[model samples]
Target: MKLYKVDAIVLRSREMRDADRILTLLSRQKGKIKAVAHGVNKPSSRKRGAVQPFCYSSFLLYRGRELDSVNQCEGIEAFSGLRADLDRISYASYLAELTDSASMEDQIDGEAFFLLLTILHLISRDGADVELLTRSFEIRLLDIAGLRPHLDNCVGCGVPVESETVGFSSSTGGVVCGRCSGIAGDVKFFPRGTVEILKLLLKWDLKKTERIKVPPRVRQQLRQIMQNYISYHLEKKLATALFLEKLYYHY
Candidate 1:
């Protein structure tokens, strides 16, 4: 059996055979891996804590004909702050799910790994606003994954947008000029501020976006727009996102 190591973050774990678990991990080198961790659920298990969702750890794995097996592991950053706060944990779960959904086994995605680690680092700290950081993360993730929205030009007409306000066409994959706005099924006009923030967030990291105070109205608009964009691309609603919305919006 061939043995190797992966620096990975645990995406999820499901119980199996009483004490073992099947783990979904997003690895720095392997992209995504499904590995079996034997005895992880037992009372005296050492890998129990390190195999849970959202744990960043180094995994010792052995190649198997069926699937990889976790030989041993050690925790790096458990994101302990996220565990104590319900809201932060919810958002962090969304990130983990998104990464799992977007990633593929044996496909190296350095950008996605770094972007996810960066967001987790920010969310685990105290200086960042969770909402803004989440929004920024959404934009940056898409950007790194090559799904970034076109902000400066029209998706339909191929013209430089000159309007102070414009409609975003999710179906068209970008902002639409007024002349091209009426043709898309999911087109909706956004005010100038919303458009500006959307443009700004695409290139900004957590450090650069941490201090910008977005007004409540614009923040809500950004969230709605991002949700729409994600739904259009990913074709599924994020459950943790809905939970986060309910926690914040009294829904």
Candidate 2:
């Protein structure tokens, strides 16, 4: 069998028979890959820490008939800081889960992979508001996935949406003007500022993101809108998302 080496981020892991694990990883060149790490769960195993969820590691994968086997792994950035706190850990899991759900095998998404690594690094080093970071990640993920909403113009009519109250059409993939919203069923209305905040979050980097503040109400609204958008496009609920929300709000 051929051996391949690449930089990868551990997206998720499931226990195998005993000490082994099935890892879902996102690699720089390979996109998403499912590999089994033999004997990784043992206390004395060298690969124990390397295969943990949210870890960025350099891996040597041996090709297998179905799934590749992770022969060797060396930690690049374990992102230990994210695991230091429950909130951070939960948020990191949410990001990893989203990436895993959105990505496909054999499709190289270098930009998305880099963005995920950068966001994890940022969360590890400089602490961010969990809510803001999660929302920002969701927006950026949608943008990267080519599902970014049309905030500047109406989805139905080709007019600039300048109304105080704007409506979003999940089916149409963006905001529709008050006039055009009537045609779309179950259209949700948002204050103009809310849409602007969503746009700003989409446009700015995490460093500059702190400059804008979203009120709790608006934040909640944006979260719901993003959740709807993601669910619509991905056509499934993110299992980790609810857990993160509960963890974030409960403690």
Worst 10 residues of 1 by lDDT: 202-211
For model 1, what is the C-alpha lDDT against the true structure? 0.85
Backbone clashes under 3 angstroms, per model = 0, 0
- Tell me how candidate 2 scores on lDDT: 0.87
lDDT of 2 by residue, 1-251 (tens): 39999899999999996999999999998899999999998999999998999999999999999999999999999988888788788888889999999988878899889989978877776646667767888888888888888889998987999989999978788999878988678689989999988888877878656567778889888888888888888888788877866755442
Instruction: Give one digit per residue, the lDDT tens place, for model 1 in 76-97.
Output: 9899999998878888998888
Candidate 2 positional error at 104, Å: 0.7
What lDDT does the true structure give each of the candidates? 0.85, 0.87
- The total of clashing pairs for model 1 equals 0
Can you list the residue pairs that collide in candidate 2?
A: none
Clashing pairs in 1: none
Candidate 2 clashes: the total is 0
